[model samples]
Target chain A: MTTVFKKTPVLTDTVMHYCPGCGHGIVHRLVAEVIEELGIQDRTIGFVPVGCAVFGYKYFAVDCVEAAHGRAPAAATGCKRVNPNNVVFTYQGDGDLASIGAAEIVHAAHRGEKITTIFINNAIYGMTGGQMAPTTLVGQKTTTSPYGRDPEHCGKPLRVAEMIATIEGAAYVERVSVDSVPNIIKAKAAIKKAFQCQLDGKGFALVEVLSSCPTNWGKSPAEAMDWIKSDMIPYYPLGVKKDRTNE
Target chain B: MVSKVTIDENRCKGCGLCVRACPKKIMQLSKTKLNEKGYHPAEVIDQGACIACASCARTCPDAVITVEKE
Candidate 1:
């Protein structure tokens, strides 16, 4: 039998540093696979932030950069501006993207930077020991919001994909998840399209993936996947939030 | 028909997410085996009955399993 499928060559031999049930690994593989399929490994540059995936540069065989906290988008902007032909993207978590680096991403998308971004929205912050992030759902209990995120005190969970879709410079914006096999396929397709938007010189593209944080969510790996279906999907929804490429 | 699922013992993190994802219910964690990472790697129980559905491989967070069909 032929080798129908296996780990993409884009990933290195180093085992990921993510938690046991974390979705980062799955998403990473998808991104690497997409790069491999597109034959852009040599030209791709991934930027990671100062979170659990800070060492993401080591995981992928592509040339990757470890940017400061919440600065991945800004860093990608610089790289794309200098090397317009390079395929640049950022792998950012909710806390890093929706919180600290909000302005960076906003301006980057607003300027229609020709780059792709993979946004992992697992609600709670994973790298910092489960703190309440900007994407944390209301009533979600994080380390920072021990009693449960109180909407009365803090605002509701940010709908990042929707918010970014409103910006004119963003050519493609889609929200997908890895909660199941079918969803996983859809997530990959969305990610591929996001990258294609940039490759075609359309504009900014971002695929917001609703991922799992099992360890931080105080749930089993299986339960975390289920949680994405029950809680996360309802809030984030699933589909193309924006597609300016065809227009 | 012959098919089996091969898992990279060392790369497996024993998360059991694939165990739940497998529709055939053929995957199990090795209680007697531990990888270099100190986690029990996943194992196949009924390799002969494997259909190479790849659900296990798809659900694996680590990309640790490879399903072969013949």
Candidate 2:
């Protein structure tokens, strides 16, 4: 058979530990393809956060550094500064980014750190057994919120992309999903642009991907993807939120 | 017109995302067979109708699906 779609070399042959249907695998491939397409694999430095993707170092065939929960931005900033020629990026989950690492990511963007951040927002925290994350939707029941997420008690879900776009140092911010082929294609383009923005030294670029958590959300892989389409997109909304690179 | 879709059984996690992704609703998970991964991988039920849309390959998290258009 004639070859059409094959795995990218940037991804290691190691089998991924991600739960089947989780969005991490798709996002990882997109990031790997972006790096190889840009020819920066030789000098790319990845910072994997403490989440389901904590072991991301083993999956990507590139230099990787493990960072504490919510500390990837800090590590990525230092990496980019010390090795200015190298491309530095971070892979973080909603719990790791919007909650614990919120301060670090905000400061990194504030400082105009020349690095890219691949933020995966599945709403509920994974790996830690489906705890409610900062991005969890209202009334969405999680392990931590058995009765559903109450807005009066928990306040509203944080819109990280919209909030980050206001920061003066942010170069690019876009939210995409992987529920369908068209959306997945858009996600690849957004991811590529985020990396390019960093390569061009624009500033701190972030691609907030609204991902699916089938195992955690107590839904089939297909239902989880549908959840993203019906619920997540309404609140998160897709497309670029900011682009200071044009300036 | 001939087209084909193949799955790398070892890498397949039996996620079933590809089954939902198929526009023609032709993909299904094996009920009686398991791959080396201990999971039943997806297979095409109506190979002749496959348009080589590659939607299954794109939605597959493991990148195990390969599509060829002829």
Candidate 3:
């Protein structure tokens, strides 16, 4: 018999603390698999953000540093600068990346930091009980936006991938989703390419993943997946936003 | 073609994603048994019906399912 599917060894045996059906787990597995496939397990450094995945250090079986809220990019920049040869990446959620650490991320991309960032945009703050985030879609309701998001007051959702792609320093940028098996495969491929971009001494790379928050969104797992397809994908379309690798 | 599927009962969170992804309609969450985490783990009822597509494993967020083909 041949094994068709199994867990990658880059991830620790510790069970993830994410909610059932949370996209973090799927993305986490993809990152781990990429690190393993690249054979960079020993030199990889991951920055864990202060969100639902704050415990990310416990799952990834590699060097991990806990960064202040939304400051994962800043922390990763320091680590990559110091090590130079190490593979550095940051795993951040919507609140941590688009809201609080907005400046840090933009500056990192502006400076063309040699690092990769796995940005999970679930549209709501999962760790803090589903508060409306900067990436929260128009008319989407959250704890803070109890009556549905009012774009007149709250403003439209932020498109981080597109914004980063416009920057001159960013060498690679892509937006992908994990709503289905095919998309998951594509997400992994995008992640692999982002890491390869860094290995080839390219500038900054980021893959914005349109993830789901079933519990926070007040939807069943299946419904959450469907929502990503129906609502999220339209707003945050998946594909390569920018690529300077061949150049 | 024969395929075997094994779900880590202890690791499953009863999310039912595998059940939804299974094209053969053979996967189901346990109605009687519950895991240590108090969730009904997924199980394959008609193993013969499994096509070894591994879609269930791919969609599973918890990575609890393993698929093998003979």
Candidate 4:
């Protein structure tokens, strides 16, 4: 039989552990495809966090290490330092990266660590039963913020990409989403470039993926996609934050 | 045309919407089982009857479904 689409080599044969309509599977596939295309699967070392994407290590076909909540960046830093010849990347969620690990991520970028960081911001905490995260939108209703996120009491969402772009140590930063085919393509390109930045010996590189949590948002898969386009995109605009070599 | 339905067990909030969305009467919620993320997911029965319409997957809020043809 002719094959229209087959599983990518970088993905494991085991079934995925993501939720239905969760964007982690799509993002994981994109990253895997890029790793295969770049032929860096064998040399890539991945650090996974403790949020919804904690099982990322099991999905990818590269060497992976699991870190404590919001500690992937620190772990990736140590990994890169020890294995200078290999490529290192960290796959983190908003709750893990933007909240608990915010300090670690900021320092990693401030120091210009030669590594790639994939930040998946779905607006809420998924693994911990849909709590309000640092990236949750204003007026967004989460389990912790049942009355909607009040800016006065809860503060505002952290725009990590824009903030990191201002740091001279960071050579590349971008925020993209997979709400549509076009957006998914753009996200893949940004992710590939983030890795390429590391390969080129550039400074800190990060890709913030504006993803969806349909279950938490109480919207269907299609509606969640629409929300990312209509609501999330405006708050986290899709584009490259910075590029040192203009590549 | 065969329809596809996938379940992301970990991401499932145990909402049972997939069971309600399946019009072909081929899905059900798991009660005796729980995934790594601590949620019971709807399982597919009689996979051969799927119409590839993706209704269950589309209606899912968690994006847990991955439907494909046989």
TM per candidate = 0.98, 0.97, 0.99, 0.79
For residues A1-247, write the lDDT of model 3, one tens digit per residue: 9999998899898989888889999999999999999999999999999999999999999999999999999999999999999999999999999999999999999999999999999999999899999999999999999999999999999999999999999999999999988999999999999999999999999999998999999999989999999999999999999999999
Error of 2 at B51 (Å): 2.0
Tell me the tens digit of each residue's lDDT in model 4 across A162-197. Answer: 999998889999999978656777888999999988
The better-scoring model by lDDT among 1 and 3 is 3
Pick out the ten consecutive residues of candidate 4 chain A with the lowest summed lDDT. A1-10
Task: Place model 2 in a CAPRI quality band.
Answer: medium
Q: Name the weakest run of 10 consecutive residues (lDDT summed) in model 3 chain A.
A: A11-20
Clashes of each: 0, 0, 0, 18
Report the Cα lDDT for candidate 1. Answer: 0.91
Return the TM-scores of chain A for each candidate in numbered order. 0.99, 0.98, 0.99, 0.97
On a 0 to 100 scale, what is the lDDT of residue A122 in model 1? 95
Off by over 4 Å in 1: none
Candidates by DockQ, descending order: 3, 2, 1, 4
Per lDDT, the best of the predicted structures is: 3
Summarize candidate 4's per-residue lDDT along B15-42 as a digit string, tens digits. Answer: 5545655678788878688887676778
Worst 10 residues of 1 chain A by lDDT: A1-10
